[model samples]
Target: MNPRITDHPAVPYERTRRVAFTFEGRTLHGYEGEPVATALHAAGVRVLSRSFKYHRPRGIGLTCGAPSCPNCQLTIDGQYGVPGCATPLRGGESVRRERAWPSADHDLFGVIDRFSPFIRAGFQFRLFRRSPRLAHLAERVMGLIAGGGREVTPDAIARAARPGLGERRTALAVVGAGVAGLAGALAAADAGLEVVLVDQGAEPGGALRAETAPVRTPDGGAAPGFALAAELAARAAAHPAIEVLTGSTALGWYEGGVLPVHTPSGVLTLRPARLLVATGDYDQPLLFPGNDRPGVMVAGAVQRLVNIDHVRPGSRAVVVTRDAYGYAVAAQLCAVGVEIAALVDPRPGERAGADAEASFPSGVAASGVPHLTGHRLREALGRRTVTGVVVEPQEGVDGRGRAVRLDCDVVVVSAGRRPAEELLLQRLYHGDITLDPGPGTALPDGVAVAGGAAGITDPAEALTTGADAGARLARWSPENPALPEISPYPLSPGQAGRPSSSGGTSE
Candidate 1:
C-alpha cells in the first residue's frame, strides 16, 4: 500500500488543486503544480531512477532542471526517457516505468557480476587481448543492447511534459542568473522587452556563488567569482525591465517560448518572446568503483556546501584532479579551515600557470592522483556510509590493485563540467540550436548568447558581456569578448592557454 497524497494539518500546505499521476502504472497523487520529483520525494520515493551502464540506484540531486543525471528518468503514461527532475506533475497523467528487463531492482543483466573476477575498470582492451573471439562476441552483444542501456533517445525526451503551463507570459526569458545569463538578460532587456531571468540558487549568481577561487582582475584587485556575482546581481536587479527570479529554475521549456520556472513557492509559466539560455555547467564526477560513497562529491557541490549553505561536506577530504581549477577549490576549502588529506593531480609538473599555480594550497600532499601512473578509485570503504577511499592502480583484477584507503569521508572529484545544455539540446534536436561551428544556431534568432553560453568564462567578462548584451538589445555593437586567460572550466591544470591580446578567448 502507498501513502495517499494528503495535506496534513500538521504542516501548512500551499496548493488547492490536487493532481493524479502514475509512475510505472502505479497510481500516485500530487499537487496540481508541483515538480514530479518533488511529489516523488514527498511520497517517500527516494530512488527516483537509476543509471544507464551500471543500472545503479539514483535519486534527486540539488535541483531537477535537466536530464543530466540518471536519477529522474521514468515512464509517463506510455512515455519513457522523460527526466523526472525537469518534468512536473499534473492531474490525470499516467506514467509507466521501464525498469530493466526482468525488473528494475533485480535485473538478470547481473551477468556482468560473473565477469567482474576477470575484468576490472577500463578492462575492455585487456579482455580483448586475452580472448579475441570471446571478447568480440561480448562486445557485439553489448552494442546490440547499446551496451545494455535504456531505449530513451533524445527525441523521446523533447516530447515529454507534465501540465498546467497556461496563463503567464514573458517577452524574453533568460534561464540562468550567472555571469553569462545575466549578460544575456540585460542585453535582451535593453532591446525593450520584458525579461524573466530564472536561477536555482538563492542569489541570481550561479557558479559564481559556488566558485570560491580568487580571480585576478584587470587592476590586480583579487576578486573571487562570488564577489563579482554579488555586484552583477545588484545591477541586474536594478533593471526595471528584468524580473530577477532567484531561487527559481527553468524547470523545463515548452513550445511558444513558454518556460516554467520552479521555486520553493511553485511553478510560474513565463511566456518569453525570446530565450537567452545561460544555464551554466557542473563538474561531472567520474564513474569508478565505490564512486557513490557519501563522502565522495563533485567539487562544485562541495564548494556550494561550504560557501553558500554554510555547511561542510566533510571535515577532511581528498581532491582528485588533473586540472588547475581543482587546486583552486582545494585552496579555497583549506583557507576555510577544512582539513585537507591530499591534493592528487594526475598531471605532471604541468604548468598550472605560474601566476595562478602559485596559489595552490601549500603544505598539503599535492601529487598526481594516479600513484603508479594509472591509479583509479578502487573501493570506497564503509559498511553503512563512506569512511575512507582506496585509489588503486588502473587495470587491476578482482583483487590485484594496490589499495590506499585514506581516513577521510569526503572525496571531492574534479572530473570536469559539461555545459548545462540539456534544455539547449531540445532546440538542437528541433533544429533550433544549429550544429554551426560559429555562434551555434544563428544566435537563436533574436536570442543573444552571453556569459558561459557565449563562452565567457571570467567574472570580469561576465560583467562586460552582460552589459554588452543589454547594449546589443538596444542596437549597440559590443563585440563578443574572449574567454579569460585562465580556463574557467578547467579540466587539466596543465591545459592553460595564453589569452588573446584582448585578454580572453571567445568562440
Candidate 2:
C-alpha cells in the first residue's frame, strides 16, 4: 500500500552495491552494511535481545537501529552492548546475541518475573518508602542496570557507510517525513517557497509512507491519496526551490531556525530562516499481562514490516486496537495473504469498525476478520516468542461474544499515538521554560508541527497541512509576521508518569 515506489527520491540508489554482514559470526547478505538491524531481521533473527525489569525476552522493537537496548543487551563488533536497531550491516560486520552473566535468554535477574506478582505497577516506590536504605539502593542499581542505553560506533559507520545527497539548499527545513511534514513541504513548494523535506528513512513520505492502501481522504473524496503523495514528492523534488533529505534524520531543533539533522555523513546543523517540525506520533505500548515479548510489536511497526519492508510479521496476526489505523493496516495485511486472526476492537460501543467493508474490503479483504467488540487481551501465551493470545469477552458489549483463543505468532498493539513532545516539555510558552501544559498546543515556533505532528492525519488533511506549514513559513515576515500555534497530541486533562518543573522540563 505504500504508494507504488514513491515518486520521490529513494536512498538515491545504493552506490557501494551489496555486501556481507555477520550476525553472531553467521554471514548474511544485504545492501553492503545497510543497518545491522535490517539484516538480522531478514535472516529471521526475531529475538534481537531480552527484557529489562523481568529480563523477559525482547527483539528489535523498531527498525530504527536505535542501538542495542540495555533491557536486552548484547555483544556487537566484539564489544558488549545493545543492538543498534537502525545500524546497517556490511560484509565484515559482526552482530552477537546477548552474553550476560547467566545469559540474555535466562538472566539471573529474571527472577523478577516471579516477584512481579507482589510488585504492583509501582512496587519500587512502596519498597523504597518502607525499606528506604536497601530499597533505594536496589532501585538505583536496577535503574542503572536497566538504563537500556546504547553507544554506537559512529566513527566506523560514518567512515565506511556511503550515501549521497547532491548539492541542494532550502530556506526552511521540515523535520519528520510523516504526513504533516510532507504536507508542509508540498504547500511550501507550491507557494514558491524554498523547502527542504527531511525524513529518517530512505524516502520522503512520512507516516503516509507507513500506511497500506489509500483509505478515504478526510472527506469522502477520490484524491488518490497515495498518488497525490508520490506526485507531490515528485513535483517538489523536481522544483528548483525544494530539496528532499530522504535519509537525514533531524536530531533536534535549536534557536533561530537551526536544526541539527543526522545524516549518514555527519551531523548537519541545518540553518534555515524557518523550521517546520512536523514530527508525528510514536506508538504508545499498551500495558497488559506479558506485554513484553519478542513477537509483540506496535501496530505501526507491523504495518511498516509488511508494507514497506515487504516482510511478514507472522503467518497469522491478531490486531488489538481502539483505533481505525490498526484496522486498516490489518485489512491490508490480510489482503496480501497475511491472515488476520481477528480484529480486537476494545470499545464495543464505538462504531469505527461497523463500516469496515466501506473503508476496506470485507470478507476476503478482511476474511476471518471478525470485529470482536469489547474484546480485551487478558494475556498472551508465549514461552520465548509469541504463540497466541487470550481474550476475555465483555457481556452486553458485543451482544454476541465469549472467551476465545486465537492462534497467531504476532500481537500488534494498536493502542494509540503520543506526539514525541520531549522538545515541547523542554520549552515554555511565556516564561521561556516554565512548567504546566503547553498552551501553544501545536508545533512550536522554530518547531512547526505538520503531518500527524500537526494533527493533519490521513488522506486529505495530510496534503493540506504540509502545504499550509510550508506556505506559512514561506510567507513569514518580520514586518507583519504571524505568530505560531502548536498543539500537543496528548493534550488530555490527565496524562503522565512524572511531574513537571518550573522550567517547562518534565521529571
Task: Write down the lDDT of every candidate, Cα atoms only.
Answer: 0.56, 0.58
lDDT of 1 by residue, 117-228 (tens): 6656656667677888987787766654322344665655554433554557666677778877776676667678787788766567776765555555546676656666
lDDT per residue as tens, model 2, 51-130: 55665667655322121134334566655563455454556766676523355556666667677778676677777776
Alpha-carbon runs more than 4 Å astray in model 1: 1-170, 187-193, 216-222, 251-255, 262-268, 352-357, 361-379, 392-403, 437-440, 454-456, 476-507
Best by TM-score: 2
Residue 105 error for model 1, in Å? 16
Model 1, CA-based lDDT: 0.56
The candidate 2 region of ten consecutive residues with least summed lDDT is 498-507
lDDT of 2 at 218: 40
Q: Model 1, residue 58: displacement in angstroms?
A: 6.2
